[model samples]
Target: MIREKSKERLVISEFFKPFLRILQIFSCYSPVPASSTAYKMYSVVEVTLLIFVPCFLKTVDVLQSFTELDEALATLLIYVTFFIYTLKSISLITQKDDVRKLVRCLDLDIFQPRNTRQRNFIKGQILTSKGILTLFTAGGCFTCTLLDLQPLLINRQERNGPINFWYPVVNTTKSPAYEIAYAYESIVSITHAFTHCVLDAINIICMAFIIGQLHSIEDTLINLRSYAEKEVNIKGEPNTTEKIHVQMNILLIECVSKHRALRRFANDLNKIYTNNFFLILANCMLALAFLMYKMSKAATLDFTFIFMIFYFGTMMTLVFMCNWYGNEIIYKSGNLHTAAYSMDWPGTPISFQKNLLFTIIHLQVPIKLYALNFFLLCLESYISVVKTSWSYFVMLTTVSNN
Candidate 1:
């Protein structure tokens, strides 16, 4: 009976279970109901020991060898990447209430489907989100495994472990010490990979949901007249024409309210993530520039070369997907105005016309996600960042050759 009751109450969040499980293992976050006091403390300890401590040690190691620009640069890349991941994890924990609200909003009545068609539409989005998450998580884990396994495949005398992080009071070069360090780094590397994949997946899935909602709204708006007529017919209300107009007004009000809710959701999303996105963009561009420089200098297709190839691909995908979904949001929201205009509004009551006219006017501006208010996240920005990274790579190669 308990199991049956639980199954009956399951909501759309079942689609996100994989992502949440990954996050739980990484100690980044879990849903509010599951975030008990012990889990919170474990999250703190795991993040500090596995992420923050290594980051600090790496920073110290880099500073001690600051004059060796090339060596320091190589280590700096790892440090910067880990720093960004740690910051994102900490930020999510600190803003748990806002994130909880956002997640809870997903299960709200307004977001639920009203008919079979709507249910199918949302299910499609859920499937797409899951597919993307699976591919991304697999790719990420593969890349991290390749990087970590390089040490095992190489000669013992030449191995430097998975990462170049410094450990205090621990000689990472000796036998037992090296084995312990290797295991620790492997765990940390996998955690880092999963954290990036799952956190980014959360944001991507949220945008997917918003896109689904927008399409649902468009369909509702386009079919407003038919829906109104159906309701009027079923109710068998007197003054059928008057009842249709009344139904249209009620439906339009609901659409408008949902539109407003979506805007708020987007706003909250930006407020929490704008700065992080900006930092991530900057980090990707910088890392891509350095990776290109190194790849260009490689004389053979060695492990370093292959590793960089995978790393480079991961960064490119991250940037591209962020912009791709942001662009989708903009495009879908902009079409709302057109959807509103096509609702067969000619014979509707004056009040319905007025409400729809206001809706069309408001939606005209469209929606956009910005990175630190500097630039919009879209294909154009992605192209610009790639071009800029290429220029930097060119300059570095020229300088090195001279």
Candidate 2:
């Protein structure tokens, strides 16, 4: 029965499992449900459409002189951003086995909630973050769909398709063909939104789990100190002192091992996602700038303007969440050294103190998430991104005026 319970905790909770399914559908990768040949086939087809369709349509638009320079640039930004996502998805699929191992490491029973308080806290955090992401994604999809269909609904007299998709039909502006194109574009837009949401959620959840690990480590250190205090306070025989010392040393060793494992887990995650994060950072800046320019130049409150606003907001929120949680990891990790220092060390022998000192020094560096080993993911980097986006926006505006 104990073994069964341990296995159960090792599995992801039912509440969070659907997110994994969505990720698999969109990215062709999942930590659970391990990838198979069928999955690979499906992923290749889905990713090819997701990446190629937009680029093909935009290329046609540019060749046909169907869009202004600003509009074309904005469309190109979407194509490039989704291309980056495709590359990341390919990386994730290729490294699916390693990702599975990382997920399993995180799912170990030792990391599971030990009491009601902890269980509630973990569930609350997971639910809140998941709920927020789900709601935002739904809203974005709705907005995108509305934007796509608004023209059809608002203008019954004029027959025009929603998106500028390249159809094989020579005259797509006709009734049935136009409607078909509109429906196709709407579906594609929603699927694109769903893809973005799932990918971003995967990164967010990983950071949340790491933060939970940091909390667990801090709690273990506290419990170790309490155990040592109790051992010292108890009025025992003289020989008990050496035994208590030995017990404390054993506990410290276990703590150190756990800490080392956590560090390794973090490093592995960084290695897997670093390039993806860098791509997100680069895409966010360009998308924000292009979108802002298009929105500013718009003369009327059309679907495109409203959609751009939501799109811009979504990008900003994603960037902020990534940096916020990443900074939290760094902050929580730095506290591990403090936790070590606060332990009941004075009563212990010098050899034990040396071990603790080594642990402290090792932890002082703090765990950080970096993008391609060049840009660190933190609130400061987020601020810089916003500043850079603004600078680009200004430059674009100045050139447009001239």
lDDT top scorer: 1
Residues 1-402, model 1: lDDT tens digits: 001111233266667777777777767666765667888788788878877887787778777766754665677666667777777777776676776677777787677665566666777876887787778777888888987988777665775878767777888888898888888888889878878778888777877888888887888889888887776766666747787888888888888888888888888888877876786688788888888887887656888778888888888888888888889999999999999998889977788888989989988877788899777988998998899999988887777777
The 0-to-1 C-alpha lDDT of every candidate, in the order given, reads 0.78, 0.72
| Model 1 misplaced stretches (Cα beyond 4 Å) | 1-10, 33-37
Worst 10 residues of 2 by lDDT: 1-10
Candidate 2: the clashing residue pairs are: none
RMSD of each: 4.0, 4.1
Candidate 1: Cα lDDT at 233: 65
Model 2 CA lDDT for position 271: 87
